[model samples]
Target: MTILSYADSALSLLPPVVAIMMAIVTRRVLLSLGMGILLGAVLINDFSVIASGQYLGEQVAGLFWDDGAVNAWNMYLLGFLVLLGMITSLITVSGAASAFADWARNYIKCKRDAKLLTMFLGCVIFIDDYFNSLVVGSVARPLTDRYYVSRSKLAYILDSTAAPICVISPVSSWGAYIIALIGGILTAHGFTDSGHLSVFIQMIPMNFYAIFALLLLLCVIFWDLNVGPMRQHELNAQKGNLYDEAKGLPPGANSDLPEAKNGKILGLFLPIIVLVLATFYFMVSSGGDVLAADGKPFSILGAFEHTDVASSLFFGALVGFIATLALVLIQGLDKLYLTKGLVAGARSMLPAIYILLFAWTIAGVIGQLETGKYMASLASGNIPFALLPAVLFVLAGLTAFSTGTSWGTFGIMLPIAADMAMGTHTNMMLPMLAAVLAGAVFGDHCSPISDTTILSSTGANCHHIDHVITQLPYALIVAGISLGGYIVLGFTESLMAGLATCSILFVISILVLKFKSTQAIS
Candidate 1:
């Protein structure tokens, strides 16, 4: 049974706002989320503590073993995390990591080459954000470290490319989820003969945030566009200090792994290559007839449309773990050493698992309070249709930023944007839809409490808050540009004109960064 709803009042915003503030202040996502959950419980009991303690107990316990948001899929994700930890630990101990670093030294001669290769690898792994963020960061960090690239910058590249690429790629898990969401909405609203694939494809042109974000990453890479806290991090990195003095080496750094004396690069490459290929295969196969509404055979796009990301990724990781172990055994390493590496790898992912639980708990509490519904109703009052796209963009961004979940933001905003535009007899359907997508991603990019942010930090071995601070400036630049684009599209109703604004602003920003860097150097 759904509880904690407050009939679209200001109170629905309290839990998330408190959570966001507490996260930034304490820099402890778990504690902040717990406080938010307690606050939600109190609010549900009409701001009384008579039974709030008991209710909070149930809610917290429910996060682990409940049949709600933190159910089977959550377990699959947890399993994937542990499995991934094992793989990384294996690579570290198996000597593959050092070997790859040596191999990368020849090809990646300078900072630019290292950063660009990181970017290239990130873009290439568009299957899923979790996969992309983890794989790219792990593979590139050792290479990047040699050139004095900051962990914060590496995290930014990982985070930026992960969600943005997945959001835009039609064959990706993100796209599949979006397509399914859009498909359901389309069916409910009486639209026929049009598949979500075509709609997603058409929506691409107006996905200004995702497009410009990738472009912004290029500017940062090619032009060394360091701004805000990122610049200090970069400078400190050049001096061989990758983190702020206050935050020392993380407790679970991979330094615990016993380095092999004769590790081969292929030991690392073979397992990752297997995971990537197997994930794609399982994704297509897992969807089966779920992609077809009428019991028909699954087409290529149809398979992607119905793919189960958690299942496929878990399968890929399991296979990858086994492959990595086998490779280690064949390398003539002590069996005990291999066993230790696997256990250590799995153990290393515990922090991420705890964070994921808290994230899901808050998401659950937000759902119970109907927070997204309350947020959406803010746009329900009479408004000018011409400015709807811009309004929706800001509102959608706020929702995603508060919730720290882009998919949740999409579910709430997309339907409202669609119905609102159709009801008002406006021609902004495509733009409004695109705005929902753009704002969700932009907000997710900026949100410190976001899963992708946590995963990015985990991947790059950077302090979580460091990653959040360093990346925020870049996310805001794209957001500001996206908001302007939406406003222009609102007025002109021309996608080309609006998109042109994004391109122009990005180029100008790159030029400004270049000038800034040149001046600083001299």
Candidate 2:
């Protein structure tokens, strides 16, 4: 029995705290996470670096095999991400990406249309947030560039729809994960009768942040609701500056993908369609069916609740990659040379993979240390039950924003949220659970260190920090509205009523801001 391995000690917070502080201070995410992992290992090994060194070595070895489900999930995600990159690279090489953009350009007569197209593409690719951001950016970046739409705005649009849509959509990787989390938690708590799928579906209506964020994004696109740093970015973009000329970004791919002299839009569109269909098949097949209260197959929701999304995502990406390669090969345009895009794609994704590896390692350490449980205990006392949903929302957002991961945040907070609900018997479980999801998405949306944020920058060919700076204010506006909505829901307990009230507030606020910004522009 290790002394503190499972203890809910405050010291458990040290690792993530160290990682966050160092990431912000040095702006070196990789080095910061490594330092945090080492620091955490030392503490866990009773302050002996040599012992911790051995432990680290063991963990490195075990990452691929120590636990079956954990290893499978990790491998699946890595496979999906790398394969997706390869697909992107393949499309770019085949001129399919360029052709698609050029083909779409006829529809984009103005900046508003360009932004809306980007937003539309983002919403349509809700299979995975990672896929959505990267693909939409690549496909729409050229179109947006033609209209002088700020790279920041493109990144914003790419990011805004990616996670928000996935969070709300019932058929996404995120949906499967959320249901699994709820199912697992309720099962653990002896509430075996509870249907995690049903609960998640119900919580959808209460996901204040996602609904508002999506609505806000559409308004921002159509109404030209530029504010804060975004306004200046848009103004500069109109003057032919895509990014701030005063600052130099770190060396990265400038995204000068060649426009294919001979390419087909079908080559690009068909693969994504295949990926979606394949993922859905894998999801339903993996997620076994159950009989409903009406004694019939519970349909897609039943499949979602049981689906193995990690595996589904991996296969989906793999299918898309293979389909893209075949499509290009059939065209005989690039010949054997185009195969190189596979390696190039995976290579391009290395930085993101490294970040994910380190971030996940620390999250694992945090789990071992029971840091989440510590947080729950620390924040539990003296709060009125009616206020818990809002508090949990705020806490979740802060945790996710600092750590830069909604999935990891879900791991840390979902259990706590479930336990608190059972312990308090506060019937606010639905909204509270919803709050955690919304907050996690909100925080991830806002964080500079987030993987999606980095990918958005890479996809849009914008500086990473620039994407973060321009997007944070928008995230905050929605987050603030979410907080207020949660507070109201805690008392009213009517999901539709709460959503109706918040939607009106969001539209009114956006209209007022839209008027002010447009006047300022005129």
Candidate 3:
């Protein structure tokens, strides 16, 4: 098959649009993604049935096997999901989760405390979005459930905090990846005065959407700002219903698992602590290996830049699984019950795994179609200097939303934004780059197909579509505020002005929600 270019054409946009629309309308994610994948294959192969079939086969095969070997990244991620499911199941069956909830009830008195604790944990677990999304829910769910905090609300907090914190934290995987990209972009654009790390630090304040999203989540928790679909979820939670049971149990929840009467709280925290430590250890050690192979002295940042995240996560989860099993054995659980827990745990993760595989496959198909390239091309033309940052923000958001990957959006748009800024808005490079980062995160928050989004739902044990629908309004509000900030920054050429605008708008939005809640109460 010959390589074709959809880089310059709008046809590249069709697949994701069709997929997103179908997903929203029919609520069938796998089917929608499959349709999009097939459409992309047909279009990419110029409507040849044989070519399309072969291309689709190769794409799916390539996800698992690359260059005649296993695709370590995808396989490792799948492995981690399975291990996490088992850990969750083991924790529940061992009665660790129940004990922890009981222990927490002493310190956490109300629903507000439960939600705030969830948000706090979300911020604390900031190393990797996947880790944060999966771990925080497992830790906080019991407490939240004790207070009847809706599963959708928990999912929202997990989703909001996961990527936003990772994007801003210099020590996180997201930060390392973005900084590496920024380093290349800066070099390419003849910028040598500032280190990528310093530039990343400077851009933090300009990452308006990320900062605002976290703030919005805080306000939602503090002031009870459950607007849109989330309000219904909250009301139901207050009525002692965490979710619509008719929709069935969410992933990672196994009702068949038996709980031990004498389960210790240590059973819960021990494995989680081990998982976090082991993952961090593996990440750094793996990075050290890469640095040694390159003949470079080991540095924290250098190691992060070269770390094998997938392998690190898999090994960490594997270690955590061992810890969970040991705890169960320590409690004198029989082998039969242990086997039952393992089977139930693995069974619960199958739905999420299926959705994830299809999401990855469709993302690959969209990449082949050059969807991001087409979107980026639309913004390459001349634009008013005052609108450049805003344009880049919107463009980056659109790319990420359509393709469902923030990192992919960064790869496709960061260089373009860097070049455009250096060429036109020379002094506004940092703000422009920050806009791209903010936009990518904003888009990821709203994208139902995003891996982090799926994981958040799984971790919270919330229905995926319920999470998507309930979270959309909150994401949009912050996005709107961030867009306004970017537009102001572009026009005024002042970061402070933009920051002030966002801060004031956020406060006002919270107040408005408060007023509305008060009126509803009356």
Candidate 4:
């Protein structure tokens, strides 16, 4: 088969799985992604070489410099990584993180409560997943640690809430991406009468994966139902078997550190509030549009035309840094100490920043090789109409898992799913799209190289590997339930029925958990 034919044939399943296995075994995410991209590019190039009698190097160069490659590199992933570094750097330098940590430590006394609060905060800040991951992890890790909540658990909660919440919320960066993808599919299918924003609003409820994941996260928090690997980790943690089991030196060690006290805890709150409010103001002012106003009805979309993940984080982080500085100076903090605190915070985030860059580069390479599109095309031919939602969910999951990015997965899946829905004459668009978001989140939640996963580990002061191991079970359970829900909804086309079934299952699960807890207590 030709390269395009093979890529259109089987690159998705084989290459991504190969990449993931390589990453896990080598423990080098970037290397694995690089290999995956190389394999994909080689497959395409070799096929062309065999068919056209061209040199492999020439074909590879042409493919790499294609418009698609340039767009993938310059537009989506590169800018996103730079913005991630800047925002994360600002968060650390401002001493806003320390302030938030101290305040949460003083107020939240229980491990479960701390986890729940983190989840709630994640829901509230649905504008950007990168912002959500960095802010929530930075602020909540300290509080969660004091209560003996495992670092793994904290990472899980943070990962669970970040992308899943934002993708469903109309005000977030994920929302805008979905709308754009959906608009393209809609226009292609002669559904231009329905505005992109309007269609997104209508689809929110049908997104089974996002809805179920949030609900399940709440269950884990309030109900304390730790099944599968999460349960084992929790048991081991309680038994003092977790990594670095020894209780470190006194808690005051951190407190007494000059850098820790550089800024009052309240200082962190101010910048976060400003960033959040600014995001909301812009989102609403633009009518969830990505463009600036120009007297056109859709002028709002123009405002966000230049808005990428990096741009949003840049503005928010800048405001946060200024707020942190002003608050520290006003409180008569020593200038040296303040600078030291900021430096400390930045140092703390270094690991996460490295992980983010690697994750982005990997995703970029996958796009360059067209791995995801190949996978999507392969599945399109064989998918049964009744199984469309499940197929989409799985495809989205694999894409995010391989790429270590939920946003990229959604960008790849939404348009294809929408087009499939129209072609099949099935009303499965909303549910399928929801599955895309949910599946992407599930994979990103567990993938060790994921930015949110790294941030969750950083926030919780947990080892990154520990977080990935413990968080996997919880993510899978939610995915299992979401798959079932999507299947039901796909057949019935009844959103209400699907929700009811999920609710009943959730309630039963809670009851079972409570009974099991009572038995253990007895």
Candidate 5:
């Protein structure tokens, strides 16, 4: 039951590695995650069965009530998920989703248009990755469904866009956190000429993974680059099989309920609009208080830096739920039907919530084991200055992949990356830091236990394994391209050269995919 550091040894990597391998082989996400948690608890407890059991129990309990009080952030996020499910269900049952689809059908003539719209929404909702993941999917689902775009593809679009866009946007939650982290790193290194905001802006161009991931997504969409398992999923969709029903229904979908025929488009848009506005309002409001408490002047950046995202999302979802319920009631739907919507909504979210809880518990166990620290340790004692950016990118990606957290990787690797660059390769400091961001996101994109990835599947209403399996090829391809870019930048120390390399590689990749598709058709 006592926590111990395994950062000095290779033991820290076992749990995540076991979990990831099992998830891939068995395709039972919860069971795989549970096994990993069990293994991690045993390791932390030094192989004591009784102690491990107690530690596991405590970790589970601590998720809801930690440090003598309710865990506001975790509880609020769960609340938001439940409320979102209810809202989605209510909107559908009231026939709004159908009406929206019917209206959208008139304008969206082809599958390509449907996918383009999905990708566009994914980019536009850049306030937060979690918000972007869930909201974009809900808005785009009906249209994509009508045009037979696979849920796996929808999930891909959501996952790819969410974190990449957030990391690069200064006003986003991810950007705010990264900027603050960079500020502390700069201060520690005694660099005062440039501030965090300016540094982040400068690094944006150097963030190869984020930039290329987005561009690759566009290529996949524009060229219908259905590679690997994605090709099968897309093919199935063309035949009216949106997902493998045998894998089980998606956690966010409610198929048993009959929707009303008189649904209006207003039913869908009203709640979603309110949700976005309310969440943004609460994010700034909550962030403002923290800024004031810190004796800092109010600014958008300050607000985002101090915002309570979990609470803001919960309150916004609550308001959105009320709007959805009101709209349903105004339609004069039967009370019993309304009750069904509530139950169905809550029931549908249970699987996703369970996966989230398991993922969180395992992440905590990995944290206690100091897995990230161990990974960071490996990045030390590097050789050449020119290769530092590439090395850091790979290390950061490994850390995030193992820990199932991009933010945790950023926290651990950013300071070290900064110190390494400042001490040895001063001119490459920005590139080093940018490489960390890029790698963290790349790892997060591939990690099975990443919350954003889980939520992307939930939002797109795809089987979790299906989403993971189908998206892997695309993620790995982008990661490879990113790694190459970092190496070019590291050797040349020129951002333009690295970007040009990425651009050329990306174009070639698109053409190759196009040729492959043609071959497959022939």
Candidate 6:
């Protein structure tokens, strides 16, 4: 179909939005997303059964077999999910989580401290957002609950830190994606002569939203500023009715769930440490000349480039599996029970897998419709030079919110933003691209239907809707600060200034809220 025709038709259909709406209303995520994908395919092909079938076939093929899509599915989502499930299973089987909770109980002292610690741990696991969400939430939830820190707050901490931290960390999965896109943009814009290091460094300073958001989260933790919907939810949680009893246990109890014996914490910790070390080794080994082998320099990036995300995760999983087996054998636990733990771990990942598949399918349909290029075209003619960064940020945020996938949002926005930057003379390229990343994370951070949001809620044992409602106010506060930061960045030509401005605003906002709260109490 022609570009205009496709744009007009797809805009009218609004497949992604419609699909998500259906999922929310029906509370059947897979079914709603599936119908949405089918609708997009039919709409794209003019409702031709044969064409729709062909499109669907292509989507499946691309999702499972194509270089980019398949690699993303395997390396990032699938591997992360599998490892998360396995780790959780081992922790449960070993009673390590319960032990950790008990241990933490002595030190935490109060609900506020418990919440702060959860946020701290979330920041610590910056290797991957997906990993961060699952690990921190699972580990901290029970401890937080024992102190009466609401599950919704725990989920908020997880959701807030996951993408925000990942996007900025150079060694993270998010770092890899951003670097790859930046590399492409560099090549496209005649900046290849400056080299990748220079390009990455330039972008770092201009990543206003990312730097400021992290600062804002810290302020939120330290100042304990709760507002809007989150305040109401916290009040509800204080009343002991924050979640439905039918869903599961009280905020964090492992009651009625299997618990592992002593030393199971080692079973969980050892494997994860090994995985982190291995990931670093591999990332360095592949990067070209970052390491030495046999009196010669080696390329870690080169090796990492060839290795898929799934393979990297599999390496971690192997370590975890072996650790679990050894712990079981040494502890004299039944081998059958260990096997059962593995199965249980894999089973828990099923929900994440289904979500990944449907997300990929939706991304494919949108890509087929060439939505990115259409979006670029729309922005090309209208955006004022001064407003480019803010506009790009908002656009990226909207796309991620609509699709409920920050990675997918990144995939679409990076290329388009790159093109826009190139078209605009490369003067504001770094800030523009950084804005895209910042916006994607911002949207995903607050999106109720987002996968990270779901995983965080699951890990925290929080009601999903409760988590969404409670988290929204905090996310909006950060977003508002970020918007102002973007504006400063666009006008002042000093990214550092913009970041500093936003950070001050965030701290002031939190303090004002705290003072107001204290006054009300008096």
Winner by lDDT = 5
> C-alpha displacement of 327 in model 3, angstroms?
1.3
Q: Please give the RMSD of candidate 6 to the true structure.
A: 4.3
Which scores greater on TM-score, model 3 or model 4? 3
Per-candidate RMSD, Å: 2.2, 4.1, 1.2, 5.6, 1.0, 4.3
Candidates sorted on TM-score, descending: 5, 3, 1, 2, 6, 4
- Model 4, 82: alpha-carbon shift in Å? 9.5
What local lDDT does model 4 show for residue 380? 77
Write model 5 residue lDDT over 389-447, tens digit each, in one string. 88888999899889999999999999999888877878888999999999999899889
Clashes of each: 1, 2, 0, 12, 0, 18
What does candidate 4 score on TM? 0.79
Tell me which of candidates 2 and 5 scores higher on TM-score: 5
Q: Which 10 successive residues of model 2 have the least lDDT summed?
A: 249-258
Global Cα lDDT for candidate 3? 0.90
At residue 429, candidate 5 shows an lDDT of 89
**Model 6's lDDT to the true fold?**
0.68
Estimated TM-score for each candidate: 0.95, 0.84, 0.98, 0.79, 0.99, 0.83
Q: Is candidate 5 or candidate 6 better by lDDT?
A: 5
Backbone clashes in candidate 1 total 1
Which residue window of length 10 is worst by lDDT in model 4?
247-256
In model 6, where is the ten-residue run with the lowest total lDDT?
248-257
Worst ten-residue run, lDDT, model 3? 247-256
Estimate, for each residue in 343-371, the C-alpha lDDT of model 1 and write its tens digit.
Answer: 77877777777777787777777787888
Clashes of 6: 18
| Candidate 6 wrongly placed segments (more than 4 Å) | 1-13, 23-28, 49-72, 75-80, 193-195, 232-243, 246-255, 260-264, 282-307, 334-340, 415-425, 448-451, 458-466, 515-522
Model 2 lDDT at residue 443: 83
Candidate 4 lDDT (Cα, whole model)? Answer: 0.64
Quantify how close model 3 is to the true structure by its C-alpha RMSD in Å: 1.2
Q: Specify the poorest-scoring 10-residue window by lDDT in model 5.
A: 378-387
